[model samples]
Target: MGASLNEIKSKIASTAKTSQITGAMQMVSAAKLQKSENHAKKYQTYASKVKQVTLDLVSHDKGPSKNPMMLKREVKKTGYLVITSDRGLVGGYNANILKSVMSELMKKKNDDAFSVMALGGMGADFFKARDIKVSYELRGLSDQPNFEEVRHIVSEAVKLYQSEEFDELFVCYNHHVNSLTSEVRMEKMLPISFDDVTSTPSLDTFELEPDRDQILDQLLPQYAESLIYGSIVDAKTAEHAAGMTAMQTATDNANSVIHDLTIQFNRARQAAITQEITEIVAGAAAL
Candidate 1:
């Protein structure tokens, strides 16, 4: 009885320690999630406004101006930019993105060359270990990433597109649906399409300051860069939400284990007391 009680007590102690750690982690993740969500929400307005301006500029053109980024060519080579987290413990956040991308990649043949831009340690290491072609790797991104942090990577990706390194460019990241839900989304960044925007040209037209071609040459790259930065901002928010949920689940499981262990310990203690009382009564009867 004593041994059983002691064992249950130890289990209770271990479970309690785990609960404390998980609870702390949950709190930390919740705080980060709040900040990340705020940042994402604010940036979303900017991203939408920028998209609207670009759409109006492209759609309202009076001349036959074609942006290089909007041109669609035969798919010869592809560039895949995958965003993941630097650390684990965020449930299936990283796994879902990797798996979704892998499923798509598996459809292609070995001969088709695809360059990978891995943004985060998990993503970089995952592709590297699989012997995949990782062209550029960006790790150690902040929980709430700033545009400056993402600028170089975005510039290089655009440069690769401009140099014809990849005929098509796709970026994959976790899109934040809500605090509790996120979805993996793969969007084509190159060959910018205005499919989502209305094709109807704005009735009011403004004169181009320098000419349509020059404006597109500068504006197209900024639009492409904004796409990457906006995605990263949303992905960071999703990452924090996932982390908070994972840690909360962990804490809840630990608490359940502690509760069960506490009940077992009480039972064992009661049995020990009953055994000692019975022994005393038996000795008295024998005397």
Candidate 2:
């Protein structure tokens, strides 16, 4: 009985320790989520303005400009910029994004039809394991990422698109809905779709320095790079949110286990005490 009680006590102690660790992780992830969410929100304003400017440039054009970024060609190869987390314990965050990307890749008739630019260790490693080609990879990003940190990779991706390495590029990530929910989003990033832009009442006029074509030549690539960076920030926010929720769930489960173990310990202790009293009473009667 004592041994059983000791075992139950040990389980209770271990579960309590686990609960503490998970609780701490939950708090840390929540802090990161807040910062990441703020960064994402702030960047969206800049992204919107950039998009508006780019759209205005395209809309004001006299004729179809010969810019490669704005022209669609035969899509012999497709590129995917897949974003995932470097670390685990974020429940299904990485899994969901990776699975969606994999599903899309599986539909391809040949592996040569698509290439990947992985943005996290989890994504890079996943593609490597499956023998999927990862032409560019960036990992170890901070919880709140800055644009400069990702600019090089973004530039490289844009350069590759310009070089016609891939006819189209898509960014795959988890979109943040709320603290408890996120959804997989695969967004097309390249070929500069003019149809998607609804002309805003705000972008009425612009002062062209040289010409609209020259301005587009400079702005289009920067616009594409900004779009990639914005997606990274948004994905990071979703990652942190997922991490916070996962840790919270883990802490709750650990605490529940601790509670159950504590109950078992108490029952064993009570049983031991009752058995001792009954033994003493029987000894007295025998005497």
Compute each candidate's TM-score over C-alphas.
0.95, 0.96
Per residue, candidate 1 scores C-alpha lDDT tens digits across 105-203 of 887787356788999999999988998878999999988889999899999999999889998889999999987899999999997887675655652
Deviating ranges (above 4 Å) for candidate 1: 62-64, 199-203
In the range 72-176, model 2's lDDT, one tens digit per residue, is 999999999999999899999999999998999999999899989999999999999988788999989988989888988889889999999899999999999
Query: Model 1 lDDT vs. the true structure?
Result: 0.87
Candidate 2 Cα RMSD (Å): 1.5
Overall lDDT per candidate, in order of appearance: 0.87, 0.89
lDDT of 2 at 253: 93
Give the least accurate 10-residue stretch of model 2, judged by summed lDDT. Answer: 196-205
Give every collision pair in model 1. Answer: none
User: Which 10-residue span in candidate 1 carries the lowest summed lDDT?
Assistant: 197-206
Displacement of residue 114 (Cα, Å) in model 1 is 1.2
